[model samples]
Target: MSAPAPPSSSSSSSSSSGLVLQGADDVEDCVWENEGEGSLPWDRFGYVSDLVRNGNRAFRQHRLEFFEKAVSYYTRANQIKPNDPVILGNRCATYIRISQFLKLRSASDSEDRPLSGLDPTIHAELALKDAEKLVDIQCNSVRSFVLKASALLLLEKYDTARDTVISGLQVDPFSNSLQGALQQLEKIHASCTGSRSNTKPERTDDFDCTLCLKLLYEPITTPCGHSFCRSCLFQSMDRGNKCPLCRTVLFISPRTSAVSVTLNNIIQKNFPEEYAERKSEHDSLTNLGGDLMPLFVMDIVIPCQKYPLHIFEPRYRLMVRRIMEGNRRMGMVGIDPLTGSFAEFACEVEVTECEPLPDGRFFIEVEGRRRFRIIRSRDQDGYRVAEVEWVQDVEFPQGSRERVDLLELTSNVAEHASSWLTRARQAAQQDRAKYEKLLSLEHMMPTPRDPERFSFWLATLTKRRPDEKLDLLRMTDTRERISRGLIYLRAEEQGCRLQ
Candidate 1:
């Protein structure tokens, strides 16, 4: 028997009936009479014919259960005659029929009566597989291309489906079914394109990040031409440096690859409300609140200090990327020696410069900003996030005797700190690294007018222990902190003289 003709359209119900076994009632008898002339045994041929007949009969019933039964019967027939184009075509058609029926069924009907079998997408996938095999078996046949196109269309692969229809027309240019399918595909494609060009394009996958399934925020288009939200792309790259959509090996890093400004502007301009919502969601992750911050459990950082950090661990790399995208600030905490966990008090630091290395590491320079005491902390995406209360030094009233004394003390300490740093730099003139460090410290000095910040800058002039730095962060008495800073500077100067 010849393969069935292609369906007139993907949505046509007649596609299912197009594959009915020709003279199925008499197929067994015909097989029996021609047994001697054919290769198959008489009994097996008859059995295969009967299976095909039963599948056709069930398929004609036009019910989901009957379609499933048709698939079963056709599957058994195909197994008996492994390469039978007729059997493959009939099964492929049945699968497409079931998929179309399921898709066209009213939402209310689906909600009222739940389905338990394979879903529409799965059926289309199965149909596509069968259609592929049929094409391989009969390359010159228009029916094969038609079946493949029908399956592709059902799966929403419009481009490939259109190509398949064109290929079918090449095989049989006069085939009415293939011609009709090509026209239908063109209309569908035109409708989709027209809809997107409207003044306010509908919220479709065109503007969505496949990874987040939301409107794109800070969309970063890859070299392969796929776009994703900046955070989503890098977060995925943390696992492996490849494009999530195409799996192309990505050479771009967060620091180097900038956002697609044009695409981002289009999304923002077209869908203002949705874009605002996406921005709000993204901001919530980056900046939790005024008092809440993500913490980097590393070392103690005092205000007015600058340091370079190498972020290699996956969790930290993720955190640093988010920070760079957000406010470029995070709390830096060190382990508490006694508790062996994150310290109670930490200093906020702002990322001054960030360089993303090729091996997925970050070389970053950060400067300390302010201090905060962690009230409560929790884990977020493999990092610690804390609710904190900002720490500030108690200020004496202006022009008061106590305030004047404090100001005098601050000025004296600043002079002593500056003298100590000049001497330290001279002593370290032979050591290039140490000399450079002293110069950097010199640049970080804050004026005595802001005594709290000046105190921290003074402490940075000398290499102090982490505990001492933490104590300085905890100290609210500006005069005492300045005095302690002066003591640290004097001790370092004395040690340098001895050396």
Candidate 2:
């Protein structure tokens, strides 16, 4: 080399001071000897907490570059002090922030927007792994367990989230975060009873409801192993209680059927767009009527009549809770054997009193209000819902003669019914207890001041077939129901005379 430029005074000074310049060979030899010993592990850990805070701030700014720089700092710290609890915790937190930031971005952007990079779930999974590592490294650290549980929750791995929570509680029972997480999980489980499907078929065809000829909506799985939209299946059942696909006999009632949790979840997860559209369509349909009302599938409710109920089932308890939340109104329909569903005509009832028990059961008293006929029906949370068309009495012709004739007819029917009731009670005297019970119930029967309504209630209490009662319930003309009642009463009285 040119004259190896004389080592200036530095060489001369090294000779006097016994200090020699390090050669490349010497530097290479010492590189591994004490690579990171100058920085203590604790120093590296100290930097991690600051890096995590900066990372959080960068994430808030939506500056991916700055966030990534913070992440790099954390990584450097972690490498400097491998497996340091503080470093591991900070790195895990950084990963979680990254995922959250990405998730927020995705939520704010249009659905059709193209993703720029890796999915946020990948980061969430990575964070979950880090959190698990932290938990394993520090078994008793409540913070570690909380972090792990949070990661699992974000991943939508609920069972593992629960396990993480239980493990944390085992270590420290008084952790408020862990307890709150556990309670939240329980609420989710109860509320979304029919959640995600586990054994999903490879093809999308498996999820379709046969009746609707599309994807299942509010799917309920019957005992026959076939799934259908709640409304579609109910409509099919209206013709006959059998599985639509398999034609298997089913004894399911709207009150007792449970929605398939697994299928619901799978549909929500895989077909989010379609599911959202379906939900919007369903909501729009249900809200078409004035304040959609829950349909109570039990005995018919007549206006001004008392409807006492003992609510014990979980589904009914939920229904009653919703009822109390709103106007305390519910529609009551009789179970129609002919249709295999509730009668088309129904009545609305308002809860007047409710006594809730410790076990979520209730003793509720209600009074009937107006009559309605089901225009359409659907299932909701193991209950029936309907779009209804209200029915009212056909007002008599606006004339004195029509009013007089109506009054005369109602009076004649009431007298005939009274005579027939007395004769029947006398005829049934051989069974005095049975006759006495009928007499006792007579006082409890609804007797409105309005003659038309009174005649309707009379027909309600009369010994008649279910179909006959349903006919009386559906009659819009109160006068017609009274005339029909007279004929039935006369036939009953003649039969008694023959006996």
Candidate 3:
């Protein structure tokens, strides 16, 4: 056996130096042994650590006291670490986790539900916003991004989440967890889009396909118990990774035959009126020509994959509905603090599916195909109207489709990705069910142009100061992203450059 290597300088600031605390699952008693004195960076960390320790104990008894301790701990931590981005961010996290615990428990237990009259949806929305703020504050680490992304996902903010994660990786490309996460995001998008089946089954007019003008055949009823023709549901899953029907966990496989038949008949028979109402609601949301929006609201943006729109503000619901009325959708632009509070860069969203809720709200869905930047926004009476120009996709240089190999890079990153891909394909050949979920995971891999992998590899170049993570976050181009990765790969032990 070879001699043990020296510890990396980057890891010199080990919180528990004498004893190794490699992962979260390692419940070693000796962890605190080395953390005896002056180890923690801030007082809040110490306080939270104590709370976490006590919380663990309370959790053993499954007591309510445990969560309350955690809440108070985080609350105190947040108070001290207010302007500290990480602390502020983590405070948001603690609150979200707390709210989620309460929300989920409330969902399961009818009588035990709190009498506070707080809407879980509102609480969920707030939690997601806090996560978004952490991202805004640039305190979003890859791990924090993952956590925020989860909350956004739970809140059905799919486009917001995909955009956020992409931004995170641009900063710290060497994060394996983020890469794995982006992979998961892509699968979820695919699953959302995959709901559109080839054979349009008979149902209400709204469920019918626009392309073939036929009813959706091979109706896919997801685990959440919502059925759509296979095709329409495909990319929606990518946006949110949840069942489009009932917003539950959707596997990337087709439901059983018997189940499909049962769903089809049940939807047609028992839910026919409900389906028709939903369809009619969908048609009412469309705008064939001029905008029919309120004077106060300006533009409505249903965000898309690559659009740079900073969609915020609660009043935008009216804006979205107005856009739905005439334009069938509206432009979404990115917020530029220097230029304007509203979005300066944006894209047009073409409304595809609009499902109305019982409370008269619309579950409006749209797809973004291209990008545009608004040059000017003027008050059109009460509504906001803008002079906008298109941003061609061709303006951004894309790698040639000619076969390019990242074999050398893959050679270093443990081959976990490619090996999994191969196994997935093989599994597809053997068991269709297993293959789809595996394939779902595989499908999320970034295309060669995606700098995420390079970003992750670059992160390893040399663990610079924690400040370096910020520079990584701000990087905008692919070449730099890869260069950073290569620097680490070269500096890493005994690695070769394939390029």
**How does each model score on lDDT?**
0.73, 0.59, 0.43
Cα lDDT of model 2 by residue, 1-499, tens digit: 0111112344322122111111100100011122353333343244444554554454344344554565555554444445556556655655554444443442224124423333344455556766778888789987787667655655556677778788988998988767766777666556555554566445467878877778787788776677888666645654455677887755443213435656787788778778898887765544434746688787876765666799876667667765553567889888875987778887788885554442335678887777788888888777878878788777765557877787777776666655655666576678745554444334334343355676665654446666776676688787787778666656655553221
Report the lDDT tens digits of candidate 3 across residue range 1-499. 1112222323311122211111111111111222433233343245445544453443233223343354444434333233334443443444444334433442234233322222233334444555666566555455457556655654445566667668778878877656655666676567554555456445466555443345544466554555665434532432444565556643232211112544544455545675476546444433423332222223322222211222233244345444543555665443433545664455466654443322223455454433455566665323466666554321233344421333344344434444634543564566644443333333333444434443433343234432343344334443555566556545533443211
Cα misplacement distance, residue 182 of candidate 1 (Å) = 48
Candidate 2 TM-score versus the reference: 0.37
Which candidate number has the best TM-score? 1
Clashing pairs counted in every model: 0, 6, 49
Rate residue 482 of model 2 by lDDT: 73
Where is the poorest 10-residue window by lDDT in model 1?
A: 20-29
RMSD to the true structure for each prediction, in A, is: 27.9, 29.9, 21.8
Error of 2 at 110 (Å): 54
Query: How many clashes show up in model 1?
Result: 0
